[model samples]
Target: METRKKILITIGDPAGIGPEVALKAFLQFHDKAIVFVGDADVLSEAAALLKLNLAIRAVDSVSEAIFDKGILNIIDVGALRGLSWQKCVPTAIGGRASAQFIRCAVEIILNGGAEALVTAPISKEALMLGGVYYLGHTEMLAELSGATDYAMMLTGGRLRVILATIHTAIRNVPDMITLGRILGVIRHANTAAYMLGIIAPRIAVAGLNPHAGEAGMFGREEIEEIAPAIEAAALEGISVTGPHPPDTIFHKAYNGEVDIVVCMYHDQGLIPLKMIAFDRGVNMTIGLPFIRTSPDHGTAYDIAWQGRASATSMAEAIKMASTLRLPTWR
Candidate 1:
């Protein structure tokens, strides 16, 4: 039997599907000591909507919580008693609640109360309206944890993408894609593979333009910046290769020629990752002090309380967190 680890989960946006999917995931997986940090009322209301008889026990502290099958232990951080599900939509209150839940979870991890954290989706617009300036989980987590060199890694099935630049404007990506940034991402990607038990992992770096700038005809970002980063990573014994064409590198990844693909921009990597692992992709932050993972998708406000949301990604996030916490067998 695998040793049980304490896993902390944050209900991202109370108005979104975070509560619903969180409830469903815990109902399925009962091995680890999972603590759901959010508004208890939101969780109960979601359970009621699903017509499922789930036991939601409130705990004053992380240590007081019981981790057993058939019970969803919660540490209520927000007072969502009077808030209706209808008002849960991207309002300031909902955004504040979501931010509160996230901060509470981070505190739990920082204080040595939890081994890992699994966050649900949060709305960016809601976060702004609630007076939180962070764009999303990655940026907020990096700031709260005081991590200077961190990268966003997305994993699903056999495909893994590590972004060189995330949450930036397309027009701004080229300027941000400096030699140091690409080299930093490569280092982070190496660390991530090590955590996943993949020593000597084959790393692939994608190009910034068609045919990798056609040897500097289309663009020089690849020839000038990307190629140098790959060379630097190879010198550090990373088994790195690329400046491969963005169009065909993914195909190589799918066929097992690559273990992780390093991309220059956001859509360059995610467009293919979501296409392959739409339902079960897991977003992980590399180079943090503690292990962190979340469902790759966002808050589906359109189907928040309709009982139509799929919990596959949530369950996978929980599973990935648990696995990452375990001592690597290899």
Candidate 2:
């Protein structure tokens, strides 16, 4: 029999519901071997709170892990000292632990000890309070892995969105939607589709302005920047389409008219995809040397430790990671 792939699962912020969802996903997908990279004590407490029957074994590395039933192999990062989970307030120890867990997980992936990484939701504010100066997992991972260009792709069952600019203010999106950036996003989306086993993926480009700038009446970005980018992609033999209006492009893509939609801004893509499949959408980082995915949601501090967290997105993330192979890193 073939051996199961080893995936590194990081339980983000102990003060949040990372541990709970991690356990829940593991229980649902018991056949795959997962090495939980976080504090064992926190996972233990979460398992108890959820009334799950499982065992936690501390392993030094992923190779030493034994794929067994009902046992969760973990690389213990140690528990948060003097951290209270009664409320979702951020503490120094919790923030430090979250950053440490991310660092350790990246190291494990770099060393070939893990095949893929599935990260739980993490709090950006908590990480900053904990003295880390990175934007989020996608940026930190890109810097750590030395990836030059990358885009955030959110995936549900049917609707898929690749963002040209993420984590930028809406007001700044107009200026940011340059021809070079649009071309970069198209190339990344093409690469991502190939990774998912699509030979010639159909890509639709969304406009920065309403109604695709109404033929330069509302804005000139569609004519000057977006249309040229799409033309350049087409010349490369890619199946590219549109400077379509944001309103109809996502609907057409969701209905199977296109394989992927390249949105010019953050909410332009996310609002539709999340509305369609928020509970199970997976956030995939494209143009990276390695395969990295995370849940579509954030650290639900308000419902932390209340057993109200959902594991659907985490499960989908893990499944996507396992299905796709990473590009070779030079």
- On lDDT, the candidate that comes out on top is 1
Find the 10 residues in a row with the least total lDDT in model 1. 321-330
| Superposed model 2: Cα runs more than 4 Å off | 1-3, 79-87, 328-330
> Model 2: per-residue lDDT, tens digit, 1-330?
436777889998888878888888888777787899998888888899999889888889887777788898999866564555434666666777888887888888888777788888787887788788778888888888778899999998799899999987888988898989999999888888877887668999998888999999999999999999999999988889989998888778878889999998888888988898989999999876667888899878888898889999999998888887765542
Extract clashing residue pairs from model 2: none
Worst ten in a row by lDDT for model 2: 78-87
- Model 1 spans with C-alpha error above 4 angstroms: 1-3, 79-88, 325-330
Model 2 error, position 112 (Å): 1.4
What is candidate 2's local distance difference test score?
A: 0.85
- Shift of residue 311 alpha carbon in model 2, Å: 0.9
Model 2 TM-score on a 0 to 1 scale: 0.95
Which lDDT values do the candidates have, in the order given?
Answer: 0.87, 0.85
